[model samples]
Target: MAPIAAHPVRSAARTTLHTVTVAAAPDAVYRLVADVSEWPQVFGPTVHVDVLQEAPEEGGEQLLRIWATANGQVRNWTSRRVLDPAARTVTFRQVVSAAPVASMGGAWRIAPEGDGSRVELLHDYRAVDDDPAAEALIEQAVDRNSTAELDALKKTAELGADRAALHFSFHDSVRVDGDAADVFAFLDRADLWPERLPHVARLDLREDVVDGQPVVQHMDMDTRSPDGSTHNTTSIRVSFPDRRTLVYKQLRVPAAMTGHTGRWTVEPAAGTDGAWEVTSWHTVTLDPEGVRALLGPDATLADARAKVRHALGANSSTTLRHAKEFAEARAAGAPDGAGAEGARATT
Candidate 1:
């Protein structure tokens, strides 16, 4: 793989730090920050993290490859992290900076404050080529991501842990007898969702372009639940047109969930040309407090989990089923938006 192109040069080093206080204890906050694997489920800016090397239980160095949304774009980089649980701090230095970045390093510290805890995130970096514009972009990303992450940590820690709540993931897929690009287009063109998906009442979309190519999409959508409850969701999505995959994180999830992230992936079917499978895969951490408050005290974790699975499955299946029909029709030379509501539409 080619090395990422460096951004413009900058002269001085820049540092940013943000902090939040949670009603929960330091241990609670530390656990959440140290367990990097759970970041995708806890932080809205993190799309995915893969541990390339693990740190020992005693705390040492671990290497990771991370994909995250920064400045409305999906960027990836490798980093070496030093974890010190005894001191309740994790320090990381980027081994390879993504485009528009020269170098990056950060640390997370959890300190006890009375019965509660204080968590601080600190980052320092210089632009790729010491470019002032690049430095400004990095500053904006650091500020935005740090603030969002600290707020999420505060919320999660304050909730503490409920055995009734658990983290879970599952996927639903539909086979489409059409070109992968056609199927992926159905997922990518979110601005048309109001006309295509009946459940979607309204949608607002924004894109970030680099060299005339759209790299990221920010979407706000309103939809009605099965019980006719209206929900509004704000999300950031990273698109990989070449790979036929899109990953997204919900910055504002429904009341029933603590955190939610998912992907829409299109894969060519094995042993069959022009046939493909589109999958909607989700991972979420349920909020038992929300469940009890929203679904009544009678609701159990099982019930909450079930409700989530059912709701997600229903929507994904509906979309997949329609996408299959629409893409197949288009592949057959029908015009765009033709049969968008699917074959069941009577009008």
Candidate 2:
């Protein structure tokens, strides 16, 4: 299983599955189950968990205190737990010999539910005393107690207010008249991007994978107007070529602004009048912080759309000019840019 959080809470049908929403994160819920020592603070005289031995690896050994009342009779027991944190599942075996547990195991799961989380508990039960009726009742008690644990954990996690979420994509795209392979040859060159793109001044390679694709590209972008003022931002980009998307996150920016993200893309589109057209779009998102007036903070979605439109227009115009120069030079057949220096002759 990828994680227990993906599954819904379903104790055996003979048992119960009670869910009481708490104000906490899934991680907080996991902590509640993993750390039994803290139960005394939450449920005095009612619950206790003690870690007997912890193996360095996941699914290691654990010991927990077991005490409860099932039929007006006080039962004291102990369990040996094997916990797999990766799966968030625990299998408990009766260790105290005297404990009436035949088979007991359950899982603490965390799942996403809108802006909050759903904590689930999956439990299994069997009777050591050969009493099926007792097993059913025991399941009910376990479900109730596990649900309460999740509720407490949630309440604690929600104490921390919600944090902002951001998603973005950006990279100036250069297209050529040739097929994908030819266009990729030029566009994939990192050095060509900094010089050709007006905003990208430098791309510092942070780490390169086996195929030499950069896992992290420390970039220095230019936000300078024609008037000379600069607003430089450093961003980290994680790229997936198969998806044709590059996500950009702003690591640093001017002191005045907040919540910045931008994306650049190249998509082939048919021209309004004729000819195949490729549009390059760039979007930037901004959110204001430290200002609480009334309503939720505003964003830069509109401004970002406008910026993408402008960039596309400028790039199409520039591309047209460059194509004209290349075609004319190729026609002349003088080894285009043969006599010229610092020339990038595109065929």
List lDDT for all candidates, in order. 0.83, 0.46
Clash number for every model? 8, 8
Q: In model 1, which regions exceed 4 Å deviation?
A: 1-35, 47-90, 95-102, 109-121, 127-151, 154-164, 270-274, 333-347
lDDT of each residue in 83-194, candidate 2, tens digit only: 6677655556556633344666555566556666676666666666546676666765676556555554664455444322211334334433433222222333344445
By TM-score, the best candidate is 1
Candidate 1: residue pairs that collide = 8-129, 8-131, 9-129, 9-130, 9-131, 10-129, 10-130, 10-131
Overlapping backbone residue pairs in candidate 1 total: 8
Worst 10-residue lDDT window, candidate 1: 338-347
Q: Where does the lowest 10-residue lDDT sum fall in candidate 2?
A: 338-347
Candidate 1's error at 175, in angstroms? 1.4
lDDT of 1 by residue, 210-279 (tens): 5576657889999777777778999888777777888888889888887888999999877887789899
**Cα TM-score per model:** 0.73, 0.36
